[model samples]
Target: MTALRIALLGAESTGKSTLAQALHETLPVLTGLRVARVDEYLREWCDREGRTPRADEQRAIVEEQERRADALAVGHDVLIADTTGLMPALYSEYLFADTSLAAPAHHAHRRYHLSLLMATDLPWVADGMRDGPHAQAPVDRLLRRWLREGGHAFVVVQGQGPQRLEQALNAITPLLKDRAAALPPTSPSTVGKPASGGLFSRLLDRQARLPGSTRWTCELCDDPACEHALKSALPPATPRVP
Candidate 1:
């Protein structure tokens, strides 16, 4: 029972936090897996910094989030991180601006076992702490970057509340099931090498065994012109959580 690190990522006002909370509630009942949000880490970082963070401080925030995610992944059976506005690919663009900062140092994407990408289909809301109106385009760009980087993610589009919930469940349930099947069935463990075979070998086996129909596909705009239109569609962004 290795811990599954699920990361909820997207641009500002895309409902990452709400979806994380909902998944935190629903996933355990359906799969007996726990979910922890990254907000707890962000709140602690804000307290240490003495104020809410600004956009320029994104790299620092992401670093801290990664650290917290690592720590939680160590303790929990399953951890779901509510990412900052930027996805891991976009975060790398900012963190590795200086060539001296080698690629391995900013390996945020490597931390997660699964990523839930909230799509920008709903109206952009200016929540008191949210920073931008041009969130949709950046979100779209980031989603493309995630796909290009070979990251595993699913899009969640805006819809009626229940529909959005079901969409989220549908997107992640199979992943959870697959991960569960891969586990040793003895005790909760970290998501790394298994006792008999290493992580890489297990990963390759999974890929080799994947059903052809389990491939990625976009649920939004049917237009063939959409870049990465073959990538998996995300679940809709839900409202902000209280």
Candidate 2:
């Protein structure tokens, strides 16, 4: 079966790496299935070269990130991308005033079954690779704008640590269930099991659905004002398995 693709997107120090690593580790335990992760290629490039990529070097970074993700997707039940080519593409635009990477980056992003946008609610820390806290807001605005313009659906991941992982799992579990339902059971033993893929079936069966009215749509979700208003009106999300 084709792996479910999960793309994690966020500005610098917004916890993309932390959340991605959590999902990569937790998902396999929650679902008795294989999980693979493709880390941010740009991070490695920076560490190796001791500097960030130049405008001329952005395209290679985007291509390499996509290539690694594609390579990892085979034979895995899930693929979690720490970040996607959207980063380099957006950075290209934000830093170099170049818009050329947008189309290919969006094309790559569309393949993911789910996208999680890490909220900037966490405190930012200085890192050698980071552009600093000052860059987060503008970069975030650009990312939201990109998603809106592309008409892609993405859930915003909020909260801290385990709470954040739980939020992402809540968004992801439905897709897991849908995929399970679509496939035919190949064994009698597997026939009556919960669609959760394995162990945490009981917990997943009771996972809370996102509270929303019929009026909710991807377009509105990308809008910060609309999302905030809706989330503010809803009750707190149910806590996931501890």
Best by lDDT: 2
Give the lDDT of residue 196 in candidate 2: 44
- What are the per-residue Cα lDDT tens digits for candidate 2 across 94-116? 99999999999999888987778
* lDDT of candidate model 1 versus the reference: 0.53
Cα-based TM-score, every candidate: 0.64, 0.84
Q: How many residue-pair clashes does candidate 2 contain?
A: 0
Q: Which candidate number maximizes TM-score?
A: 2
Error of 2 at 8 (Å): 0.2
lDDT per residue for candidate 1 within 29-119, as digits (tens), equals 5554455666635546556777655555655655666677777776566777776323533544533443222244336565565556555
Cα displacement (angstroms), candidate 2, residue 203, comes to 4.0
lDDT of each: 0.53, 0.77
